[model samples]
Target: MFVLLITALIKYANVPDDIPARLAAARLPELVPPSSLLYLRVFMLAINLWAIVLKLQMIEDKVIFHSPESQLPRRVEIRLSGFMWCSFFTFQAWALQTFYLAGALASSMSAVYGTPDLGARLPVALWFAFEVSFAVAVLTSFIVKYVLIPRKVQNGASVAGFFGLPDLLMHNCNTLFMALELLFADLPVLLSHFPLAALWGLFYVVFSWGWLARHGVCWYEFLDPSLPKAIVMHSVVLGVLGVFFAIGAALAAGAATISSPYVRIALVLVGVASVARTGLITGIPEPPVGAKKE
Candidate 1:
């Protein structure tokens, strides 16, 4: 019966000759060869590393901003000092992908046709990186393209000069890399594992608060304690990330038995969902009433 077959595939079989696995899913080996998956991991890792290098170069060079649409005579530079480099949420999400991909790449090199013996972190980290990177990529691009750039233009300034191919690699291309890995590998995500990313967001919230206490400057307007609605902003961002994780988990779970092309089409919908969450089509996100823009 279909029920019996499903149970048989997911059930543990720790026979003397069999490999051990903590995960229950028994994926078909014919779906993808290990070598091909390994190569994809390599590509993802390399792109993240390159993006990190470019981000660091931009920071070190104190990249200045300008655009043909700008009316300002003076150039505005992206100014971050000391530990401020890690304060950006986009940077943290991008770096986390690099970290996860490097580890995933090493493990995938020897992927074989047997129950995979994986560490505690890889599965959860994969889900966390996948969800966060997708959400950040969606939100950052929209904020930059619609909100930040146009606001700067209205102010007789522009920030587009600072965005480059490196920007493309870091903020926009994350979902592509993640989707490729998802196609070739099993992205295990359970409902319980959703907290890991919320915890990650919490960790950054505390770290950013510490930076504000020590440096007396908050780079992000939403998280500034001087603002009355800062806590509300923090809660909203964390809530959005949780929504992303839940959606990603559902998509991954649904894709477990589907063909690769179907999975690809379904994954594309996640980005579209994120765009809808941003409310870009309806209106530009404005500050809550009476909260002066920092």
Candidate 2:
């Protein structure tokens, strides 16, 4: 069943190509080659979404809501939950990653095979925006389930706080915005889609804000909060990375494209290191409070 769904979902879809890349070329083409690598890029996106949905379903049934916990079954469930949470984090990280990937792939293809048509590019562009928004929605959902939900559990806050009314409304608004953007993409002017995309982004920001408030975080705690330190810690770490990337860019100058390979390699290494670190931390044992020494 999973294989069937994946194959069905990932089948290559028709794409338009007359993007910015073609405008820079000496001559513009009316249509792009269907076999062109750019046209097939959406298949890769479909595969990613299919995989995530499958893994999420599997994790929920096999680990998160397991009926029993004891002996090997208990140990396996614990390990699987940890693994599922890691998957959640990766899904979250893919937000910016997918945006860049999709943009770069499409632009690069446009450079190679020429642009398809204004009509074609509009649908694809709107699709790209919709994909990014979906990525945000999935990431936010994962963060809520694993981080915010767990923190609320630990902090004795009302479960209702975790699913506040405001966040729900913003979440629904973002969803509707994405739906409208895609609905009108090919049928209307390309520029018309931008408003919906912008609205989605705005609602997303508001949703994140409401998330923080619902979590009981104060503005002062933005830097370093004792409660749910992961939020602050991840922010600081990403900030440091942004700084490092900026410095690298400055040092590389115009010819810094030569260093692109090394940067890509370094990113892979960091991802591996993070996965290992998560595994190690999850493996640690937690002692019960007020338990007498054995």
TM-scores of the models, in the order given: 0.66, 0.33
Assess candidate 1 and give its lDDT: 0.54
| Residue 171, model 2: Cα distance from true site in angstroms | 23
Report every candidate's CA lDDT. 0.54, 0.35
Task: Write model 1 residue lDDT over 1-294, tens digit each, in one string.
Answer: 212322243334222222212122223346556666666677778878877776666544343333323332224445664445556766777777676677566556435443344554344434445555554555555555555555654544434443566665655566556555545556554556455566667777787778656655454555555566667878887777667667666666766556675556666656554433222354434444554332
Where does candidate 1 stray beyond 4 Å? 1-32, 59-84, 112-157, 257-263, 266-294
Residue 87's C-alpha lDDT in candidate 1? 65
Candidate 1: residue 37 Cα off by (Å): 1.5
* Candidate 1's TM-score: 0.66
- Lowest-lDDT window of 10 residues in candidate 2? 66-75
Over 4 Å off, model 2: 1-47, 55-93, 117-206, 212-238, 247-294
lDDT of 1 at 173: 62
